[model samples]
Target chain A: MLKIHGIARSRAFRCIWAAEEAGLPYEVVPLGFAPGFKLERPLAINPNNKIPALEDGDLVLFESLAINLHIAAKAGAPLMPTGDDASRVMQWTLWTGTEVEAHVMRWGYNAYIKPEAERIASEAAAGKEALDLRLAVLERELAQRPYLVGNGFTVADLNLACVLYGPWLNGYDLAPFPKVKAWLDTCLTRPAALRARKLREG
Target chain B: MLKIHGIARSRAFRCIWAAEEAGLPYEVVPLGFAPGFKLERPLAINPNNKIPALEDGDLVLFESLAINLHIAAKAGAPLMPTGDDASRVMQWTLWTGTEVEAHVMRWGYNAYIKPEAERIASEAAAGKEALDLRLAVLERELAQRPYLVGNGFTVADLNLACVLYGPWLNGYDLAPFPKVKAWLDTCLTRPAALRARKLREG
Candidate 1:
């Protein structure tokens, strides 16, 4: 009953993980930003022409994290905890976008997108250092709790996990942060989260 | 009373503008993401040490746009319009973050932060192109409707207007996009918007 339009490898991963975690049945229309008839269709749904545009009944929203949070909130489930802890939960999601995700993009671009001759060794090094520092913050925060939001799992953890795991796919290591490594183990063990990853990876 | 921490030049401008537009009275605390006392405060509201945090009673939140949307929704006197037309309004806000704000950061960094001689002329040119493309999109979208939604001004317009106008401070121009310029003129010139900008820039 919901329509999600985006390619799996793009920002759409956030929404895919979110939908699977929420147990919501939805259709995935694999589309991206490049010019094409299909891309035009998603653009109609999202004027900005961004990925992971969602249509739920009459409601439509874009912005990868916003879509995830919306699904988690509307599902009225534990993927997003409620009450006094709610703001902090939201804080984590925003943290990834503001801090971790920014560095991930820089590092990911350097590792893959930038031409070898054009790559800036210093920028990549700086990005890696910043990423590790961020993970250290996360490591300390996650050490006291099973998930990013405390004893229960939420979209916040899932969002961060996706970013942490992405760099590893390209050969970055997570061994330096024991707590983050363990947190990743706990997050991957979730049936729903794994299911979502399986579908995306497939 | 609500408390918002951050300066007018910061992203906190969005949160403060939303509070004012919603007619919600708030107090502003001078804060910027820099080394100082605010970062040392234990049980600090923001874990990443970023700014533009809001405290209403015990409900604390950060991320300027998120706080804006949250405030708008709760104010029933929302800055967003109603009905199916509302999605278009929503789209504008997302575009602000994805397009206008993004390119602003790009050129802003190059023109202001990036050291001269090291700054790539291509990046600055790309910023010009991005500004043109974004303004053109805004022009086409705004031409069809009086506001981003319909005839009513919403927070969507406010957010985009704030972002679109930033390049002006850096001496960047938007002279070609008459429609966008007119739309900003109407939206930003309003009493509420003027007041909010005054408070933010005051």
Candidate 2:
């Protein structure tokens, strides 16, 4: 059995969504946090001690996006693209990690996660401004295509949608980028994504 | 021939290095920054207006690491690992982007890029402290094996070596992590990397 070592509420949610999409049965090890939100202990599987490490027999792996890519590769086709489309998948995935995610997290933490008193309004506003610039790029791309790669849903959509999910659920308005909002809705409404959301909500 | 649409000084250096390693012929389209180091105009090839976009036939891709992955995929074999090792390559690449690169850049900018008057000693120290934690993880992994993936040099090593190149070149000492220093030396000294360095230097 494949084991994912992290809580559902963490970035591990991405791997869970990917596993669900790929129809890969996996167990969550429910690793929790120490005080101050640190990992409870150093993870042997991930020397960086971050959450969402995947264990597949002897092959232990870290990085949530990379784990999803591996799951897609293992499941093959539909989830993973072939030929140059594979590169497109990677392009969007890497783009989201570098360009979109940090801003999303900053906004999410201030808007949703942090205690109200600890939240910095300026930081959240700055994050949103940064996101507005990047979302315009995504909005343009989504206006041209139904999905991130090719015409079908793939791990790229899954990876990016999961990154946006936090802010979306916390009522971050997507009205500004209708195409992005529509595309994200199409991605999150999939049966697999719904199932993954159930695990997260629980 | 691949047309890499960025100068050698930007993150595009990674792609240039990867092309050299893969023995692929490529041309650089010099992209210059504006007065504040911002892109002078919105780039058509990359809506993000980022440097290091790769143009291959009809496919246009941004994100330097992703471009290198694509180049590796095109070249195949020794540069791009097969099977699960491909996942390992993705793993290290993503890990470096998320966990390592920003800190390296922070340290690099304060230590090397910014005029001395603009450099913040505390920020540089903080970046170094954060990098020390991450490098310890890398040091452990390198100590276990000479290369990042499998027994051979692959894109993972190439991706990470380039990220550290700025700090390493600016005299950030790697003496504390002897294994990481040795492995980086091995990677940077390759003929391909030297060729890429010449492009950067010239």
Among all windows of 10 consecutive residues in model 2 chain A, the one with the lowest summed lDDT is: A32-41
What TM-score does the predicted chain A of each candidate obtain versus native chain A?
0.88, 0.95
lDDT of 1 by residue, B1-202 (tens): 8788887667777777788788888888877744453444533766557777888787777677657766666564447554544444444554565456767777777776578877877887888887777777677776787777656778777777777656754667767877777787887777877776786556
lDDT per residue for candidate 1 within A1-202, as digits (tens), equals 6678887767787788788888889888878744452566427877666687888887788777767777777675578776545556556665666667768878878876578888887887778899988888788877677786757888788777776667756666688888888888777657876776776677
Compose the digit string of candidate 2's lDDT tens values, residues B96-172.
88888889988888988899999999999999999989889999999888899999999999989999988777898
Write down the TM-score of every candidate: 0.80, 0.96
Chain B, candidate 2: TM-score: 0.96
- Model 2, residue A181: distance off in Å is 1.1
List, residue by residue over A1-202, the lDDT tens digit for candidate 2: 7799887778898998999999988999877563345566667768887898999888899999999999999998889989888999898888878888889988888887999999999989999999989899999998898999989999999989999998778898789999999988899989999988888886
Native contacts recovered, in order, as a fraction for each? 0.24, 0.84
Model 1 residue B149 lDDT? 67
